[model samples]
Target chain A: NAGVTQTPKFRILKIGQSMTLQCTQDMNHNYMYWYRQDPGMGLKLIYYSVGAGITDKGEVPNGYNVSRSTTEDFPLRLELAAPSQTSVYFCASSYEDRGLGGYTFGSGTRLTVV
Target chain B: AQSVTQLDSQVPVFEEAPVELRCNYSSSVSVYLFWYVQYPNQGLQLLLKYLSGSTLVKGINGFEAEFNKSQTSFHLRKPSVHISDTAEYFCAVSDAGGGSYIPTFGRGTSLIVHP
Candidate 1:
């Protein structure tokens, strides 16, 4: 079973191009997150959603936007792609716990901006 | 803000040899710790975690970690490693209380098991 799914496994965008990175989870988890990993670095949270119609910015939310339209979908939008935004994006979901615990991650989408 | 640090950038060990990956965290409040492994071109996989009860936690592939609250560290260890065990390991931490429990990941440690 697919826990969390991400679309466009790989994408290349022009400097001023725009695209949407799609993410969906079948776990029915209330907490969903989007993270980006740069070369030789750790995962940085871009945005997160507690549930449908609830969203918040994370550590590196600049130049990126996210919306949780439904319990299963949280799509990330990019207005103008930049080289700095080129990284592997991962979608994750976890059950809400008072003390945050574990997460199930997606296969990831590799994005490259020229 | 919660932050995690993986001391070793890379660890190289011979097959069937024991290995340890060090991790440290900094947070104002009580925190939950986790260790995740990522193989080449794949997503992170949960190896083990320390929620509250036990200090020592076991996970898949004969891996384990001990949570040292005093030192604010959770290091992963394997008695013996196989060639297939080579991968990147990440340490993460999150707040224990109310605020949105968003996880913070470390830079990651690469494990190289050579035969």
Candidate 2:
């Protein structure tokens, strides 16, 4: 199983430009999340989905949007990129809530906004 | 609401020495605690988690953590360190009684191991 996969391992975008960060999981997990990591900032949740067709805003959702159309995919969209949005993005999946089962994470996507 | 605090921003240690990384959390309801390790340019990997059962939980790479509900702490420890153990560690808490299971992560602690 591929676990969780995030695409475009590296990307550079100009200010005001937009792009999507892709995420997919083969575990058939019910929960999926998108997080951004910055120096000394750990990881901040950007968006999450409990299951297909369901999505919710997270702690730092200001510059992102997510949709869970299929059980395997949840992609994050940046309407307008900013320098502050430059960070490493990660996708994680869990089988249940409360971390009854630990989370599986993807390598990460390093985004640089200039 | 839930929050996690990693007491130290960085911890430097010599190889073969014992080390501890402190973590404290605050939450009104029951909470599930977890420790994750992140290597350079990679995602966080679960070192261990406290869902229920024993207060002490052991994880991969010879790492372990003990959950103290009274102190609201879950400190990670290792008897001996290796240079390869140098990485960023994070503490997270998920409120089990809340409607959402989204966890709150600490700012992270960088563990630098010296040879």
Candidate 3:
């Protein structure tokens, strides 16, 4: 099974442009997360969802919105792209009840804002 | 508030040498600790975690970490290093007392292994 999948492996957006980063998981996990990693910096949480129809803001949720409509899908939206938002975005999923196994991450989407 | 600190920003070592990446965390309540590795242009992968049980946790690729409650540290160690082990490592912490599932990650430490 495809553990986790993220689309648009690479993208370049002009200032003020907008785009959506799509994520999907086949594990039927209850927890999904969005994170962005900048150069020399750790991954910062952008958004998270405990389950379908539930979403919450994370540490760096500014300029981003997320929705969890189905168990398999959770997408992140950027209203207005900025240079500061240029980084590698990753989508992850985990089983909340089973805390032993850790999160599974997608390949990642490299976004560059000019 | 929960926070994780990876003291070293970069570590350079020769192949076949032992290496240690130091990590320290601060939290008022009980918490879960984790170490994740990210290869160049790749997503983060779980290296190991300290949820409960033994203080020492072993992970894939011959890596391990020991959780010290008193020092509030979870330092990753490897007896021998390979050039392939070069990557960025992150230390993260999350509260285990409640429904707090969000983890706070440290800035990250870059491990560079030279042959």
**Candidate 1 lDDT tens digits, A1-114:** 788899989999999899999999898898888999986689998999889999999889999999998999999999999999999999889888432557888989999999
DockQ of each candidate's interface versus the true one?
Answer: 0.62, 0.79, 0.61
Residue pairs in collision within model 1: none
Off by over 4 Å in 2: none
Compute the DockQ of candidate 1. Answer: 0.62
The interface root-mean-square deviations, each candidate in sequence, come to 2.0, 1.1, 2.2
Could you tell me which residue pairs clash in candidate 2? none
- Backbone collision count in every prediction? 0, 0, 0
Q: Determine the C-alpha RMSD for candidate 2 after optimal superposition of all C-alphas.
A: 1.1
Q: Which ten residues in a row have the lowest lDDT in candidate 2 chain B?
A: B95-104
Residue A104 C-alpha lDDT in model 3: 91
Assess candidate 2 and give its lDDT: 0.92
Across B1-115, the per-residue lDDT of candidate 3 in tens digits comes to 6878899999999999999999999875778999999898778899999998999999999999999998999999999999999999999888888756678889999999999
Please write out the lDDT profile of model 3 over residues A13-103, one tens digit for every residue: 9999999999999999999999998877788889988899999888889999999999999999999999999999999999983344788
Reference-based lDDT, residue A25, model 1:
89
Go through the candidates in order and give each one's C-alpha lDDT: 0.90, 0.92, 0.91
Q: Which segments of model 1 are wrong by more than 4 Å? A: A97-101, B98-100
For model 3, what is the alpha-carbon lDDT of residue A53? 99
lDDT tens readout by residue for model 2, B1-115: 7888999999999999999999999865788889999998888888999988999999999999999988999999999999999999999998878456788899999999999
Q: Quote the chain B TM-score of every prediction.
A: 0.96, 0.97, 0.97
